[model samples]
Target: MIPTKLIPRTAEASEPPLLIKSLLAQSLKYEPQREIVYRDLFRMNYVEFNQRVRRLANVLAELGVKPGDTVAVLDWDSHRYLECFFGVTSAGAILHTVNVRLSPAQILYTMNHAEDKVVLIHEDFLPILTAIKDQLTTVDKFVVLSDKVYGETAPDVLSGIADYFSGEYEALLKEASSDYDFPDFDENTWATTFYTTGTTGNPKGVYFSHRQLFMHTMGLLTYIIGYEAMPFKGSTDVYMPITPMFHVHAWGFPFLATMMSAKQVYPGRYEPELLLKLLIKEGVTLSHCVPTILNMLVSSPAAQKFRDNLSRWKVLIGGSALTKGLAQAATDLGITVMSGYGMSETAPVMAVGYLNEQEQQLPKEDQLELRTRAGRISPFIEMRLMDDEGNFVPHDGHSLGEIVARGPWLTQGYYNDPERGAELWKGGWLHTGDVASISPDYWVMIADRTKDVIKTGGEWVSSLDMENILSQVEGVAESAVIGLPDARWGERPHALIVQKPGYNLTAEAIKSGLKDQVERGELHKWYVPDRILFVPEIPKTSVGKIDKKRIRSEMKEQILTS
Candidate 1:
């Protein structure tokens, strides 16, 4: 009775709904021998990778991980985490990647809130678990993942506790059967859950369905490289994820890399030296990280020593804007850098700064400027610039508005908090809480985060704009701008600067440079900060973005004392 054209019902037509497992199976066929390296210690081909993942699913079953059970992970980015992405989810259990950087109380809250039944923890975080084990209510078992063999020197904190200690990760896989019967489930089933660290209060959990995760991976694959002259070359690219796996699925690269069957390198911990060595040794061509990580890498002595090796590396910078000064510095070090944008919501990635045909043909400097924008939305995503009154704003490249989006891969709502969830999805669009200007050509240039914008005399000033200008000041290493309360103007901007070694930077010099730019019409005069503070370092959040909330509190006390 169905139309012939609509027949996914044919016997030959699998008609299977979208799911994440299909990505894993299809990628192995492309490059089965592609290697996945873990630190400087371990390496495995795609075939071996599949076997290990299957073994993990089998072992998880033996540990009594049931459907709907949350299997939490507390580890650095490694091959093991990649396996957990698939094996746990493929086994029909939700994968809860615990943010190890969270405080003991915060970590306990997320684990308890997610109601995680099993935790696959790295040896490093054993002390953290030991401290909070008494308070953990939902965690039934703890599986240790160690680089070295356990039981030889297995700390009592890990192996001695019989009630909570389940087994070692590798040992369980080796002892379990390899034949994993991954059954078909509704594609809308919950696959992964992770918490978002807002400026204050307890973290809120955001979850994604299997279909959403699968579609996000596909969207990245299609838009990033499916078009011509893109950076990554499918199976030929060497990928290393610098972003923590716990943060936004490492911005969804592990899945995309697995789907491409590309050579992957997972740095267990992010040490600047270790990362530089890996890039040179493994020939890592493509990676994604925040501005802080890239700045750390290019500013390192190792980068200067291995400048030639860095030339071949292409990095996508997100988590914050890619300032022109930072991009130029990376270029000088021979690293190709571009800005990308996303959040913990929207399955993490909705836009990347890729060049179109016309934009690509422009001058290199102009191209760099164009490419630093949070480019057009991902394919199949519906984006709009909404004004304060909820009307769509014009895309004339000057009018700024909040960037809202809707798509298949976007998270339906915040997990367990209907009130906040409703706010997130208000007006049928996922509120990004980021203000941006869109050009008629479809470029989305982010101006500022709604909360981070500085209000002076009731006029808006971008903290990022101040930071960008400060970044260009001679002898300035990094800069962060925050809005401080002022009785006269309501709020004035404050600048925090970290100086480069061997260079003496004074507040007057910075102010003078900013004044020159303002006179040249390059920047608005109101964008200038009221005060400049030279600090040894800026405080950062768990994922390495500037901790404005903490800095604001601490700096206020310092100002009062001074």
Candidate 2:
């Protein structure tokens, strides 16, 4: 075996660590005047934003937050939260962006598991904190974030635990100096932590180091900027994140946008009307979200008025599969829509849909088909499909297998659960648990989640494929397909659909539509759902993916009772 060579460092050599603070510094140097807006409440440039971040670091120090301490943030998407992305990590503390959408018990479980020492909570979530404050083992201080001013007393909801209150967010920052010297630390130091929104047990903890996040940001920038075929995102682009910041660093775009010095907008809470208003008023050019939020935006009555302004928007959909129907709807509005694929464990981005020059010349419909796929493997990412027997599957666009990936930025393991961590990285690759196929040209088409794929009569059926076909059907608003127990077949596919307003859709009509797909060879005969149930809504996880586990459970109960 050949010995690996090593390079010795000189005493005078300056090797600065790739830290989160460097991103802020680069943004200030490039475009200090670029605006960072927070839902019409506040607006500051990169310079001012940098100052607030420094003040936040100083405040943490005053609150006795030492390096390696966990500081949890419970707030809507706002400028303050953006500051914490850099402030807490740059100061050497781990920033735990608490998913405020989780139930009270789940939220408490995450906080306690993380052993959060300080909490910066929004006023709206005071009741949740009030309910669980007694159970919080390590938290010693609380800082309130609010749009309104609280003079001397805390809000009514904090009546019982006001003694634990440190101060308000703005008040603490104002008191702290804006020029603390942020110390440089090892790039491999853990910078941020959050819990995954799993369906079964307590959410698993995922943490990232400074180097991992920095590289993730750079990897996404290389794809978005280096490839002209990809969605247009540049320094001049006005960026807003519809995806909650709590989720995988908002897919790591906040850091990328900051590094590029793009104008940033943070919509405080996701209101359809407010998001639309911000799109027009702030001239938001680039954004990313799940399919449900995009559907809500395009289908909203408020969006009808701003169609002209929104025509220039470019959206990257992820956190779930992007159905052809939803992609077409967004495209019809002149919005540039594409899909990407990742999970909570992969630092959340491994591939994004883009068309090469040759493929871009194809018909619009063909292009849309490619754009809605899971996308090609991203730069610096090594991806392969492994069959059930652990052999590598060919990228023939037909053979299906679970997607496993190896990348510099992929999470090393779940924070404190070595048993699950070992399972996640069983073969030196992160198992994505996604059933998919890769084309010869490296395009990834996700068939279904490993657990969500239906096996009917020993034939596999992709729920995503079925739902995509149903989405194109007339009068179908949104759809979800789950496997139900069967007597003869191992399992049968059942679809729960949300009908469009003013359309009286029936099971027969939907079946007839899918039958046409079968004739056209677009769908397998067995892929058609045996039962089409019309429902008002489908349950969603905290991050907006369909809750198939929940749907499957409910249907099993109904079947037994019937």
Candidate 3:
């Protein structure tokens, strides 16, 4: 039997499990006249919002979508994408969100892997989809979600065996049933599937069940209110999900925004300047984004304009490590910045670095430092770090090991790949394959990926430590460390550097930074990178993590051609 404690009956629980359905009901019940605003469109209230979601679901069914059928959406963050996220999942269909940033082949591969029955595509991506239509196998229909209505094509642009409809999403929803008796969906039913953009291999698809999502939604609700001894969420809080919905439900902000009745905004396409403008104009109280994105935004010339706006903004950083420099900048600007960590497979929120009971009384600077570290394990999660021998590592924040986790919201396996699924679920635990150290306080600090860990002269070196230290150097914009092939030591550390604009970086300076580490005994003399190569910029994966694979590929090409 499922623990009642696991699924608490809060005031939010009185509503239906059809999350969109409940959201619609809430808007009508508490604030019938309150605005549910989007870019260029305002959903007047729950009444109008519910009707549209219902119609969209009906239109999807009319276009041949069935329960369990995957309906892929490819678009920037927008109200249309948000509507479809709820409408598709509400209809007992799996919402497969494609990362539009991926190349044509990668996008096609993900769609085919999901066996998407219909593609509710953005009009902007039509040309690209048209180009690859010949290769897609399972797509039976194409419903082009447009802000404006358009007529049928005079000429055949796509050679796919499917009908196309270019319909205004809002109008189509007017034609759908406002009161949909949603199918009694089993909690174990698949709700969504997405591919993880792992730096090493082809993206692996991970899916979530309805029950898992329900639990995730609850966890998000708990997180927003700081239920696990976090900063209390206020009703006046304004939310801007700079993170796209395609990225783990925008880290569950969309659901929480509606549940908490906060003003919700989506940056149609993330531009740092535009984001700052919105933050200033909209008086956004909270936002979530990666450290890199924040770094770029705060460094922009226009950032000065939002100086006072920054004071009211509370930000959460994820995707990659949140460095002390970036955190200090945000803190100095009065931005309440905290680091959070999760993988795509874990519904993307295993832990948030909010103050607990003991942390609450600490001085501001002390609290800020704690906020930078991955906080204690969340209520719903159980985490452990283990070595290859299955021995548990000490939580003294010094010993590094692999992070493995299991929880209600954690994914069980990849969509169809059994071999990888077994590896991911080895020992009945979802292995993160990320090397990290946990403190006695239960704070988790990721050192580097297990595959990226460097070995030199029979000793291990942390690539993340080297990269972090390198980033502190003047004239260095970004840096990456990787284990390169070496005859004597099996693998040696290699450095890839992106110099600041108008600056020239030398290998000598990077070696100098490590020379101190060598003297201090933090690193051995031979563990330093033998060569440093400067690049135009660091390549990033779809979700914005540094793509070391691309660096290795370019280096290999340069070597072979030379």
- What TM-scores do the predictions have? 0.96, 0.97, 0.88
Clashes of each: 0, 0, 0
lDDT of 1: 0.87
lDDT of candidate 2 over 386-496, digit per residue (tens): 988888999999999999999989999988899889989988888989999999998999999999999999999999998998898888889999998899999999999
RMSD of 3: 4.4
**Model 1, poorest ten-residue lDDT window?**
150-159
Best by lDDT: 2
Candidate 2 backbone collisions, by pair: none
Q: Which portions of model 3 miss their true places by more than 4 Å? A: 1-24, 32-34, 40-44, 147-163, 199-202, 228-234, 357-368, 501-505, 516-528, 556-562
Superposing all C-alpha atoms, what RMSD in Å does each candidate have to the true structure? 2.5, 1.7, 4.4
lDDT per prediction?
0.87, 0.89, 0.75
Alpha-carbon error at 386 in model 1, in Å?
A: 1.0
Error of 3 at 354 (Å): 2.2
Candidate 3 whole-model C-alpha lDDT, 0 to 1: 0.75
True-vs-predicted CA distance for residue 171, candidate 1, Å? 1.2
Clashes of 2: 0
Candidate 1: misplaced stretches above 4 Å? Answer: 1-14, 150-160, 228-230
Please say which candidate is ahead in TM-score: 2 or 3: 2
Task: Give the clashing residue pairs of candidate 1, or none.
Answer: none
